[model samples]
Structure formats: C-alpha cells, structure tokens
Target: MTAEHYFSAEPATPDQRGEIAFNVAGRDYRMTVASGVFSAGRLDPGTAVLLRKGDLPDAGTAGTFLDLGCGYGPIACVLASEAPRAVVHAVDVNSRARELTALNAEALGLAGRVRVAAPGEVPDDVSFDQIWSNPPTHVGKAELRALMERWLPRLAPGGVAWLVINRHLGGDSLHAWLVERGWQVERIASQKGFRVLRVAGKTD
Candidate 1:
C-alpha cells in the first residue's frame, strides 16, 4: 500500500472524523476534520499565524477570494464570514479535505459563499481579488514553486495575496524568489517563527 500524505489526491487512510475549534478576529469557529487531511487534530500553527498576523477582510469587503490549499476550510470559512458580500474559492488537492471543507462551510451556514473544489475544478475564467494560503512546504521546493506559478497569475489587477511560511522552511527564500519573479513582496509580520508575507503585482 502506498503511504498517504495530506497532499494525496485520494487518501487511503480511514476517515476518522472529529472537530476543531478556534477563534480568529474575535470570531469563534468550529470545523469538522477527519484523518488523512492536513491538521486533522487542530488548527495548523502557520494557518493560525496567517489569520492572526495577516490583514483580514472586513464585512464591507466584496470580491472574489481564493483560499488555496484549503484544509477543511478554516481560512475559507473565516473569509466568507468576515466578508459576507464576498465569495471564497477553497481549493485543495485532497478529496477528503475538499469534502470536509464543504461540510464545515455548510455547518457554518457559509455553503452559499464558500466554493470548495479540487485544484482543477476552479473555472478558467475566474480571477481572484485576494488570495490567502498557508501553503504546504513539505511538497518540496519545486512543487511549491509550481503551485505559486500556477495560481499567483490568477490574481486580478490590484489584488493581493497573503501567505504565511515557516522561517525554517524557506520562508525568506520564497520572499526573495517572489521578488526575483517581479512580484512585490513584503514581510508584513513575523511571529512564532512564521513570516506573514503580503504579495502584489509589481508596478513599474
């Protein structure tokens, strides 16, 4: 049997389901999680730091947003809740993760606004006003770079992306790489060994 990673397209592990609760931006969230997904036991530290340190949309915020690599929809749900007028596209490679994200969005009454899908399922015509991610660094540098290359270009003009990366896991190098790619990247916050980066298209 092949080993299962959280990035597995279809995890072979048993779906031992549970719930995780956390608060972000003064709002409490309880989400359903299962085995074979990323951070099935709790909110991931990088994700928590991203939500805490990154700038979140307010109620008045309106636009299409992407929560790339959404694991059970914590970031997607929060974005939908915070910006009721906005739509959040929660994309993940893991089928179980997509299922859990859909379930949690429905539970939180955010099913209408949170669009959970596999990476390929998002429409080609859609572009995002904002993108948020605590990307999977364990995927190796090449795969990680490919992920960015695949998605970062989907940002609408004037759009911004928020990302949190562990310092020990090439966070600084990623920032440098983005700059080299002609994107404007700034380290907006650093806490608990994670760096929150604000990235935007370069203006010349």
Candidate 2:
C-alpha cells in the first residue's frame, strides 16, 4: 500500500488509457499510455532528448541492459529492438507502469527479451552493461539520490549510463554529484532544456 504518485508501488487510480505516437531513429512507435503513469500524454521531452542524443547500442552489441524507471517501455522496446542480442530489464515502481510496459513489449514482439518488473523484483545477482533512465526528478532530491545509489553501483565495470534531466531541475548539480562520487560524467547533448549525460564508470 504505497502512495499513488507515478512512483507509487501500486497506484489506486483506474487506468484510463491513451496512446502516444512518435518515431525514434527512423522507426515509428505508438506506445500504450495510461493514467497514473509518467508522461502519459506524450513521449517525455527529456526521454526524447536522451534517446535522440545518447549513443544507442548497435545490433552487434550484446549485453544486459537496464531501463530504470521505465514508464511504458519505450526505452526498453527501443533497446531490445536495436540490439536483438541484448536483454533488457524494464523496472518501475508503478505497477500500472509495469503493466503497460509488459503490454507494450508484447505488442512489439519483444516479450522474449524485455523483462518488465517492479523495482524490488530485480534479481540481486543481476547487473547491467548499460543503464538508461529519465529518472523521476520530481520525486525529490533524497529519493532521487537514493534511486541512483541503489542502481548505479550495479553498473558492470566499464559500463555506461545514459540519463536525461531537465536542466532547471538540478541537472547540473546532479552531474557534479556524480563526479564527486567518482563517475566520469559528460554532458553528451542538450536540447529543449534537457541535459543528456553520458555517465561512465571510473577507469583511473
């Protein structure tokens, strides 16, 4: 019984469904949207920027990927579609979001590769070669930092994370924070007030 925000473990609101149509990397996508999910109205601008700016893995790339805070599985589907050899884990706190992600993955015929789950359902032994997120910055600083801490540490050695944050929403500060914590963070791109960060594990 958690609260009913988009970050809630179980949202109490009925799912009044909608759909968002967009194209990514020359491919068209029309994903399922529902009430109580993040960015149900459209593909979030930050996510759009991240997907456009980040260097997505190619078909030959093979590894485990994590789409932390995946909403309706846009990132997950894209990742799976781009790199058929890779496996994706789409984790979200919102149960409805998880449901929509699973449905969307199935719709895309990616159910065999995209594993949707609640945050706690991820296996402890699993780590990721790539982590992609447009995290919930509105979830407050403490919760946001905690979210990063829990997952960022699980990045496989030399792996990278692609993240997008609204520039006005502590984006610069979050970049600094990650630097202080020893990650090599770079502002890969910025558009529409969103900063795309390429976060890599420390090598030196």
lDDT top scorer: 1
Model 1: pairs clashing at backbone N, Cα or C within 3 Å: none
Clashes of each: 0, 0
**lDDT of model 1, residue 89:** 98
RMSD to the true structure for each prediction, in A, is 1.7, 2.1
In candidate 1, what are the lDDT values of residues 36-129, reduced to their tens digit?
A: 9998889999999999988999999999999999988999999999999999999999999999999999999999999999999999999999
| Candidate 1 displacement at residue 31 in angstroms | 0.9
Number of the predicted model whose TM-score against the real structure is largest: 1
TM-scores, each model vs. reference: 0.97, 0.96
Q: State how far residue 191 of model 2 sits from its true place (Å).
A: 1.0
lDDT of model number 1:
0.93
Computed on alpha carbons, the lDDT of every model, listed in order, comes to 0.93, 0.91
User: Which segments of model 1 are wrong by more than 4 Å?
Assistant: 1-4
